[model samples]
Target: MIRIAQLSCGAEYSGIQRELERAAEIVGAKMISPEVSLEDVMDVEKRFGVSVPSGDLNLIMARATRLVENPDLADAVFVATCFRCAEGAIIRGEVRRYIHEHSRLPVLSYSFTERTTAETLLTRMEALVTTARMRGLLARERQTGLTAGIDSGSTTTKAVIMRDNQIIGRGWVPTTEVIKSAEEAFQQALQESGVKREEIQGIGVTGYGRFLVGKHFDAKLIQEEITVNSKGAVFLANAQKGPATVIDIGGMDNKAISVQDGVPGSFTMGGICAGASGRFLELTARRLGVNITDLGKLALRGSYKSVPMNSYCIVFGTQSLVNSLSKGARPEDVAMAACHSVAEQVFEQQLQEVEVKQPVIMVGGTSLIEGLPKAMEDLLGIEIIVPNHAQYIGAVGAALLVSGMLEV
Candidate 1:
């Protein structure tokens, strides 16, 4: 496999790097970039006696050298530079020269400006990845078989079966006993697909109880929820033609993942509090004498825009809702407010520093709530993409991971 090391500076270049990652994926090369800190740059300048003109440039150069010199880390190097920045241009040249002299690795560079379009960046990146592939830098063995992925989420267990790169069957059931729930879901999927257990090549597991479920099923691969979700989002985006930012709101926790080039770039998760999760919404809905399924629809009928909820604690928020109802607040208005509160918690607390780009992909059980996505779109000013089987995305992603392993 070709592992390409990436070097870039500044938050301004993040979008450009994401586009580069997408391009690399199209050509089957894995990209790995190390994070660089200001202190690390200063240490490099003092230790190596290399004159770095600026802290940003110093950090880029330092990270580049470290990645290039580690044979296990990268097989080639890729650099991105700002178009009109003289300092960036100088640093890129120095970094490239140093890598070529010391490691003799192939280095490909791309320049981008503030006005650079996604198409332009992708075009250049495709060429670079293609060149690396042609030079025999990428290789992989091939395998073929059916695979199963099971996701044992906090409130639900989901299983999916895949064969020949397509989903054959899937099943979902509420989570009760971890082992029983996983087995029930997997059996349903297997029966639907008409595939015997012995025919399955491998099984992969993920989610809150992934370790337990994996052990129970004797799964060959076990992975975290974030990694599998990102992989699943990337798989979905490939069919639609763009990168995706996945927002997964489950029963207990919520996650936000940024996927570029069929891989996860960055992610953030909500705190341990259940205030921003599906369970909170269900509890609040019951207190208001409304069904959880009807909450989203009723919220859309609301005409009043109330103040943001002061507290995100589930207990406090429930009490506040009761108080609001006593003051003649409509049920619809309260429900909409709850949705807004959840969105606010995710954006303001969890994803405070993360950049959320469009076509936002909404997943998990809470994503099925109509008012929640609307509230989120209103807050972020971007359209949300809710896939057909949002709740099963993590399971599908786990299956994809097993498929890749079979090829290796």
Candidate 2:
């Protein structure tokens, strides 16, 4: 079992520590809290250059420093704090960064509310386990034989057929019935690739409906999108050999992942509201009387600064759009503002949790939006690469990883 060290404060008092352990147990991993001495706790303030009144917080710092000194104590690190505690939040980031920089172990950081449940942490734990146990598979540089990957996402379903490191076919469609949509996408890919179904050696499924679709298709791999999407993003961008960051702004959520050598070392996903998601942009395009595709081009023609927008809630974001148009703001400017609003929230909520490394690759359907990437570039002050077929990221990742199963 992968041993995941927990460096957290307030989880026990907040009554959510059991949820964390349950999440790790469900993913077939062990959650271990490193032993720290009273002496070690006392020296933490002097050694780490931080002072805290809370003994629990001090112990957290001591545990983090101990992990750095003894890297093999855990396969990965999970740093967390109560969402309501300001000091714990700050120290959480410091601990995460400290462990990440000092050791090669994968690190995941989260701020949990009292309501946080095992289901909420399941994906994170699964990603940690996958990162620790499947490094060789994730670091595999090439695809072999025939494989197909299907992404049953919240907004759309995508399918890809790959043969020996090259994509031969692709399919995309709006999500309706989960199994029906997945099958439709797979059939389209199968027909496009001109390959018989029986000849394909492996199949992979990912996204929100992965469990349902994976069971229906007998998928060789049923994985979460965090690891799968990062792999696909780097693969499509051809940045698998070095450090890279992937930002996927999806319909329901957003993910910011920091990767090294094609494997995800750290990642953050989800947001406070839909204001930071592609769905918000879809609403913006509807109000502007333009197709979603045209919103990007329209945004490029105007400046976001000309319009006042909210990035906190989707309802308020749409209200801002209505009020802007009422005030005679150009549809073009409104378009840019909407894109920037989503980008801004993503930058604040998700990007801040993980260290951003370059070359940054933006994937998912939202990446096709010219203004979204442009807005991210403006916020990040770096060029964002939207690779060919960026929209099929999950499907591509599924296809790529399942190819490894063919060798066995």
Candidate 3:
């Protein structure tokens, strides 16, 4: 039986421990969590050269260190922390590094806050267990047959063709009718790749309109956007050796996905309100009498720092932009301010339940807005990675899924 060492700050969360136990059962793993106390923390700090800060994180690190050192404790380690606590982030990074350097055990990390739902945590824990069981099994023979993946996103439909594990063709179209857009994108890709429909062995569909496309086109595989996006980002960034965080800014929404060992451990999505998504930028650009394509360049030209917009609703935020313009704020300043507002909304609202780690991969059509990634990087204090074909990554990921290269 696989044994997993579960470590956490032990913060008071209503029914969270029970949920963790349930997750272990679902993943077929026996959970072992050692009791941590203040004295234990101090001893670890003194004896093992591990720093113990004055907070709940101190307890978590002490317990985690013991689990890492004791080979008999478990076959894998799982760490949980509160996303809102800055100390938790520090502890998570430190403990993850220590475990990786000291032992060869698989480690998974999760962040929970007041708003974290049980369903979300369970999904991540299951993915972690699946990854652990499948580790070191990535070696596979190259696939020769043609496979295709279609991503019918809210804003655009994208398609890609893969042959011999290489992207032979890709296409995208602004979404109007879901089925029509998907058909167009797929046909374009097929034309470019010169791969006939009869030759394609498998077809996978993903994104918001996945079901619509899957039902209409008879797709062989259907998967959630978060799962496919994680697979795609990891492949595009070539970061399969380590963990990565994928920030995908789509047309109507945004998603932050934490990928541990090529599988999605956890993910967070923007609220129903379109305040923090690509639509916000498009609306704000039109209100400012600038094309959406030019908004990024205009923001970069701003000479003054703009005040952060505080409205949580996109409608109210658009009005605020107009008010700022009426108050003699420069167009460039307002554009920059809108970009900052988008980043603020993502971090404060969308990502309140997840700890964002480095080597962040930015994707989606909204990510093409040059200033948004820069704004996010400035706010997060980390460099952001934008791949060459960021917009079509979901389609690429779907194709990879069809090729049996990544686990769903």
Candidate 4:
């Protein structure tokens, strides 16, 4: 069995350990002998006395080279390390150092969605080039030709392959290095589409990493969220008129795009504090012992009484969860508070004060909340709709931006 070691700063998150376990089980792999362990990485933080907020990501990152370089550690096939930080070079340099000085295991260092999103942007851009090749071979002359698009966000990298106007394959992976992650996702989607690389016709890229991706792929690249979001919106629009407000809760930000006649016309996005966005919901869900996807469902039958959960700051909101638990609050009420909190923070009072006439499109990963739609509907006096493939919207939109290529 292939063994993998997962080490993150104690300050980073235990969730990193949990995710490593889940990935291993899916691949029929095993954990390292010690499974999960931590080497004190708090020295740097102690030196600063406040969250590094900018340098070294975390203290643990700078020391990875020393920990993984142990000579006895040759058995690992995968080494997944999560570090919170500011620069990609800082993270990648340490991983390279460990590989050269310690074990030779194939390694991947994870940048939690907060700092930088996507696994490898360059890799994914290259992979989309491959996807474009496959599109041509699979259905060169079909209007529903195979095509690929990628959306790189602050939190995740999503890719999708569509064949002749119908959905055939899709992939949603955490965004790290936008390029590499994009390549992996595009390759995976093509594999599922059963088309080899030469069959792809074209590729499109959109979002935070789009400019960087554009520098890599020979295919077309776009940076407009409006175009990209709309590309995805049309697929999920509830009617010819569609939903009134599109709520996009992204990893680092939240955007409120108003839809007029099924197209985005104007928008508002929250500031860095996350007053209105997806991260708050994700953090809240984690603390509540429920997956974000289960959050909406959990809120379905909750009592109307709420704890008033709006806060622009994610850190303050976290503290709020702790306080609520101590006060003997039900998880459901807290979940409702979370839903209401994000909605209120994400949109203007104009958004809340207005008795939501249009169906709200809760886009992005937060829509996965199983109970949020209900809680939101209850508080805002309006219904919410989470699309089946809401998570892939950005990727689909990005791929759609790929210019039609000469079938080669």
Candidate 5:
């Protein structure tokens, strides 16, 4: 079994440690804590250049040091802290960064509430285990055969056809029934690519409805979005050999992943509210009496500073949009404010959990929104790459990875 070292503060006291262990076990990995002596704990601040008044946090640092010194003690690292503890959050990021920089271990950092459950941490644990166990698969630079990938997402279903590492055809439509939407998109791709279903050597499925779609399509691989999306983003951007960050703001949730050499190290997903997602922008576009695609270009023509937006709640944000319009705020200004609102929340809620690396790749359908990526670029103060086929990322990733399973 893969050993996933646990470096955490307050999980035991908060009574969520069992959930963490159970999550690891469900993913076929064991969660272990590295041993640290009292002296090691005492000298943690001296070694790491960070001091904390909490004794438990200091002990956590000591364990991090031990893991760094003895990289073989764990195959991957899980660093967690209490959601209510501001100090613990800072330490969590620092410890995660330290581990990723100092060792080859894949790191996953999370902030747990008292009600956190095994299901909540299962995907993350599984992704960490996949990154550690399947490094060779993740490192494959090219696709070798004809393949198909399907992404059944919350708001839309997408499919892509790739032959010899080249995307030949793609299909996209708003999601309705899971299987129906997947099949519709898949058929569209097949018709465009001029290939029969049986001609494809491999198939992969991902996103929210992956299991159902995978079962229906007899998919060779079914994976979560963290690893699959990261792989596709890096592959599409042609940044397979260096440190990079990927941001995908989906309709219902968001994902921020930090990767190294095409393999994911640390990632964060989900948000407290839909105000941080593309759904909020859809609502904003509706209230502004324009199509969603036009919102981004409209925002580019206006200044967000003239409008005040609520980034914490979707309902309140809609209300703010109404109020701003009542006060005669420009539609363009409201649009820009909405884009900035979602970008700021993503930065606070998800991006802070992992280290931000260069060559940031933004994927998903939302990346096509001009204002969203522009807003992200302004906030991060770096150029963000939106590669070709950004909207078909999950499908592209699924297709690329499933090709590895074909016999040479």
Candidate 6:
């Protein structure tokens, strides 16, 4: 169904706008405009403090089937593209609330550090549907009870409730202080699942911030991300697949791993770089006048020469992009350049200690960017395979792990 997309990445707003053209290509997809609904326009005043323009909000609020039947013509829209530049996940939290209150369609939100692609973007959307379907089966009947897993990623918090390895409910929220976000999203999934707190047999937490909340969980499993990630990946990847490298771009950090036998064996981290994580891509997308979700598809054009961006520092990059534009650099080129630098840096970091595994797994929000994986895979000379549930990996693993565990 054609729907409105409300994108609020970080600072690089101009970069995003120029990158999200693919979103406009969805068969029935309609880009938001003033003609559809009021609340979705860029800086469209909140008339009477209730609704504004652009049908993005209404579309989100409306059921998908109904949207298909009585499709809102004013489907597409562009937000400020730069609401809270450095607010981190706080802005995401607020954005989610805004999309929830305004639109009737299921909001398709994606964040980036460098750039993502269409395949990666669809993988996330697929994860949501798969999780929802898995949730349906648990409702039929069960005896072992249900469990919830909380993946406290550096940028976002995702929770899943499952019974017998099947997802019963899921929740995705930005990470605002690890423990707090975990608690909040945990409660949300429980409420959404309509399952009582006591009914939850166990809880698992993963990612960089997992430790902070591990103490609070029903039973915290402080294992490597590769372990938890593979647990989730194997479920989504084709059975014919073999050893692979997984590159997970979180909001605050980046992880690279080698997985074989459906388990993580070796891995590395690039520390935390606000200038080059999934959120940065989002900010850049917004700056370029495109949606982050549309970044990868737009970048696929790859014809123009890239505009040079000196530093990966967010603020510096923002200023540099403006100066580059003034210097007459093509927007497409500039966006791809930013993605290139990030890919180069990631490859350098991942290849520092160990050789990168072939058939790589590109997970997290950054993977969804259109051309990012292509660029990175080329640089690393390896195949990159992004799984369907990449974003929900930590949450899904934690949930499945907790489902059969005895109380600890």
User: How well does each candidate superpose onto the true structure, as a TM-score?
Assistant: 0.66, 0.98, 0.72, 0.59, 0.98, 0.57
lDDT-better candidate, 1 vs 5 = 5
* Tens-place lDDT digits, model 4, residues 116-182: 2222222222222222223232122122466777777778877788776555777777778888877
Clashes of each: 0, 0, 0, 53, 0, 67
Give candidate 6's error at residue 39 in angstroms: 76
Question: Which one wins by lDDT: 5 or 6?
Answer: 5
- In angstroms, the error of model 1 at 109 is 27
How well does candidate 3 score on lDDT at residue 106? 61
lDDT of 1 by residue, 1-408 (tens): 577787776525445555666666755677787765566666776635575666767777878757655745776677667756777766776676566446635555545656555454442344344334432211111113698999999999999998876778898999999989999999999998999988999998988788899998889867667667756655654432344678887898777755444444344555436778888788768877888889888888873377346337887877777888888888888888888778777765445323366778888878777888888888888888877777788888778777767655
| Residue 119 alpha-carbon offset, candidate 1, angstroms | 42
Cα RMSD to the true fold for all candidates: 11.8, 1.1, 5.1, 16.9, 1.1, 20.1
| C-alpha RMSD in Å of predicted model 1 compared with the true structure | 11.8
Q: Which of the two, 3 or 4, has more lDDT?
A: 3
lDDT of 6 by residue, 328-401 (tens): 87767767766765676676544432325566677776777857887787777767777775677777766665
Q: Pairs clashing in candidate 1?
A: none
lDDT of 3 by residue, 155-230 (tens): 8899999987788888889899999999999999999999887888888888878889999888876665776777
Please provide, for model 5 over 1-408, each residue's C-alpha lDDT reduced to its tens digit, 9 standing for 90 to 100: 989999988899889989999999999999999999988998887888987998888888999999999998999999888897999988888888888888889998888988999999987898899999888888877987899999999999999999998998799989999999999999999999999989999999999999899999999999988899999999999999989999999999999999888999889888989999999999999988999989999999987899999778999988899999999999999999999999999988999988899999999998888899999999999999999899999999999999987853
Clash count, predicted structure 3:
0
List of clashing residue pairs for candidate 2: none
Which runs in model 6 stand beyond 4 Å of their true positions?
Answer: 1-145, 191-194, 220-226, 238-242, 271-273, 302-304, 310-316
- lDDT accuracy of residue 12 in candidate 3: 55
Task: Quote the positional error of residue 190 for candidate 3 in Å.
Answer: 2.9
